[model samples]
Target: MKTIALTVATAALGTDAFADSSLPGMTGTDHVGFTVPSVDEAVTFSQDVIGCNVFYPLGPFSGGDSTWMADHLNVDAKAEIPTMQLVRCGYGANFEIFEYTAPDQDTKLPRNSDIGGHHIAFYTTDMDGAVSYLQDKGIEVLGNPTTMTDGPSAGETWVYFLAPWGMQLELVSYPDGKAYEAEYDERLWDPRP
Candidate 1:
């Protein structure tokens, strides 16, 4: 069992396994897709609060009499997408916001501890001002901004908040860069322009 566990860990880490095989002509991420309870409401918040620019909107698609939805999107065959739109915020990856309808749809927002749970983090130079702005807009700011003063994350500050639909969002700032920057050549994607 120990040997099997080690093998699995090595495979997951990809230390040497499948080193040569990679996606051809691959580049950095272009966009991140997520479904929201209401596309219009999501777009409004993204635009009015987050300052995102909404791009072209897509159609209300259905699978009809086929299993195209299940086969292609891995969703229920009868699932439908009522509305979808692409949004660009700052210099990070664009967002593909979707509104889906299905018989088995789950409306509850998952906690960060749950599998497949996620949040969109925005970078800001003024963490305090951003938190105050959210509060002024009646947005739910989870707690005070946490500043990491030690370890690799030193010089970083972050706080989580919630969207009107209960989706998780975060504000992160590291104006002077994190401590890890000095120890490594490669760095995480910087949102600063």
Candidate 2:
């Protein structure tokens, strides 16, 4: 694990990059979308265990055998995105899950070091109870919970776990708040109850 350092200078936004005019009064995250091997299983896990509620379902969408989708979404134009479901995951952003049948789709889960590899982390009030519950339900927890010893994340405890389909997930808890939060007037949204 790496200890991320945050300083006033490091936190300043850089002005050298090409900047588009910001969207006026822009809101926060709308959703985080990801492709899944099976949307049905993803939905079941999210709803039954993760406590998300289905927003809606969409698709069987294609680009009508043309290059429209290839140019826009970078998918094969003839590919079929069989299903898409939006689900609200607690007080955080929604998840847009997809099931696609494409000519060049890769089903293997990527390592965190691989480009675009990522994991979704949920905050909890009790790390031990949460880990125990997931284990009893047969989910693969990678290791025991680790408590951060220093830096902004000190006092936090977290552990990585795997979904049934092998997509990585994490559970973190810091009921007393993190070291960095004390410096800010407003804190970021925490999933803890």
Candidate 3:
């Protein structure tokens, strides 16, 4: 797998790269998908804690007597999806949360340094208020909010926290914008409205 990934990465670094060759008509990220332990608990945490709106529910899908699951989703052939949901926090992309049951499933949550480690960051205008809110709710905040003092992210303040189910999340604020905005006209995608 590492060799295959290296080959693909090497190929991508070649000079054939061009703006026009990118996915046609692609706009931006639509949603991020992940499998959770429980859909009900995830929905509650997303809505009550993270301030997300639960859009809808889906699934209870299984490919019985077929290889559809493995062929399409690259999961175990006998895997079953009991519940799934779509949620939107504020202004950026939505989240597709799934609850799956499989024979070979690994329930361990990966750390940020692990191969598939990931975290969701939400934007806010008030860093102090946001951090206080999380703390008041009995959430396990990793550390005090940090304000970048140098480089491109000089004006940004951020902090990391953990969900009840151990998913890593972050709250970031850059109300006056970052230092990089002064150096370049192009900007990273801003979730703030």
Best lDDT among the predictions, by candidate number: 1
> Over the stretch 28-69, how does candidate 2's per-residue lDDT look in tens digits?
467999888999999999998878898899997888868888
RMSD of 2: 7.4
Give the Cα error of residue 145 in candidate 3, in Å: 0.6
- TM-scores of all candidate predictions against the true structure: 0.88, 0.84, 0.88
**Stretches of candidate 1 exceeding 4 Å from the true structure:** 1-21
The residue-by-residue lDDT of candidate 1 on 50-151, one tens digit each, is 999989999799999899999999999999998999999977788999999998888888888899989999999889999999999999999899999999
TM-score of 2: 0.84
The deviation in Å at residue 7 for candidate 2 is 29
lDDT per residue (tens digit) for residues 1-193 in model 3: 5345535854785544234447865545789998889999999999998899899899899999899999999999999999899999888688999999999999999999999999999998888888899999998999899999899999999999999999999999998889999999767877666
Ranking of models by TM-score = 1, 3, 2
Candidate 2, pairs of clashing residues: none
